[model samples]
Target: MEKTLSVQGMSCGHCKMSVEGALKDLDGVSAAEVNLEAGSVDVTYDSEKVTVDAMIDAIEEQGYEVS
Candidate 1:
């Protein structure tokens, strides 16, 4: 499934990559795209292996906030 999450604290390409990398590293995540300008992250992942809450936590662990 795909999910779009509102993310904050992304100010540059590096920040975007950080969020993307975090999400991609998760077992169920197939892809992740972070838009710094829109402050959002679009991710394609397996719902059976991962949850939205886990995605939020991964983003937050990279110093970003998900709303």
Candidate 2:
């Protein structure tokens, strides 16, 4: 499944990569694209293994807020 999360506080490429890396590290995540300009994250993963709440937590762990 695919999920798009509205993330705040991403100001640079580093922040984008941080979010991407964190999400991709999760077991079922296949792809994570962070658009700094839009402050959004596009994620593709297995919903059965990873939940939206977990994804939010991963984004938060990277110092970003998901809405």
lDDT of 1: 0.94
1-67 per-residue lDDT for model 2 (tens digits): 9989999999998998899999999999999998888889999999889998999998899888889
Alpha carbon RMSD to native, model 1:
0.6
TM-score of each: 0.96, 0.96
In model 2, residue pairs whose N, Cα or C atoms come closer than 3 Å (at least 3 residues apart or on different chains), thus clashing, are none
lDDT of 1 at 28: 99
List candidate 1 stretches off by more than 4 Å: none
Residue 21 accuracy (lDDT) in model 1 = 93
* Candidate 2 residue runs with Cα over 4 Å from true position: none
Clashing pairs in 1: none
